[model samples]
Target: MADWGAIGAVKSAVNIPVIANGDIIDAPSASRALELSGADGVMIGRGAQGQPWVLAQIAAELAGQVYRGPQGHALADVILKHYEDVIRFYGPDLGVRNARKHLTWYLERLEGGMELRNLIIRERDASVVLKRLTEGLKNCGPIIEVAA
Candidate 1:
């Protein structure tokens, strides 16, 4: 749980905007944090993990807008694009190493993903990782069409 009381004290003592942070994972948590802290806003850190859409989801809740997370091919597209960018920036070897955590996070929620995630995380070659990932997505159903 977050120390929302401490945050309230800070808000009362300061004239500047106080943004409550830590442990805010969803709309309900974010709302509760603000109600308790009386802060101007909240910040999301680890909540993003594999699901980058969390920020948008929370924001929409605040604004009373309807939004849903990406799924199926959309999810595959986001994951694949992120992997490609990481590889481009870090090169094949280091990229594969760095991307394991993110991939692990992304795939953890997928049905029947444990063995596939373990395989991808252990592989050293970037090409093989990408191949396995693409194939793994296919195995899940509705394969992502990565643009060539």
Candidate 2:
């Protein structure tokens, strides 16, 4: 969790808009951070690692708008699209290496994904990685495991 007290102090001192960061993962946490820090907004780092739509989801929740996160095939499509974009921007060689971290993050919460994660992270070929990712996403069910 963020030191919202310190953030509040900063907010009290500054004239510009304050954006609270750290541990603001979900909508509830984001709301709490804003309330505790008295900030205009919150910034998320690790929280938005693989699930990039999280910030927008938080925003919608804050605004009392209907927000639905991607699931199933939709979520798979998003992950694949992100992968392809990274490859396009960085080229296959660097992109595969760079995207491993993001792919790992994406698979962190998935069920039956450990094997896929291992394969995806180790494989250098973008096409092979993509195929594995698609298959993994399709096969793996939603089963988030809490880290100890």
> What are the runs in model 2 whose C-alpha is more than 4 Å off?
143-145
**Distance from true location, Cα of 61 in model 2, Å:** 2.5
Per-prediction TM-score, please?
0.88, 0.89
Residue 4's lDDT in candidate 2 = 78
Model 2 has how many clashing residue pairs? 0
Error of 1 at 23 (Å): 1.2
Residue 67 C-alpha lDDT in model 2: 69
Score residue 136 of candidate 2 by CA lDDT: 79
Q: Residue 132's C-alpha lDDT in candidate 2? A: 83
The TM-score between candidate 1 and the true structure equals: 0.88
- Over all chains combined, what TM-score does candidate 2 have? 0.89
Compose the digit string of candidate 2's lDDT tens values, residues 25-96: 888898888888899988999888767888889999889986677888888898899999999999999999
Write one digit per residue (lDDT tens) for candidate 1, span 1-148. 7898789999999899999998998899999999999999999888888789989989998899967778788888898899999999999889989999989877776765556798788899988999899888766643222211
Cα-lDDT of candidate 2? 0.85
Which prediction has the highest TM-score against the true structure? 2
Worst-scoring 10-residue span by lDDT in model 2? 139-148
* Lowest lDDT block of 10, candidate 1: 139-148
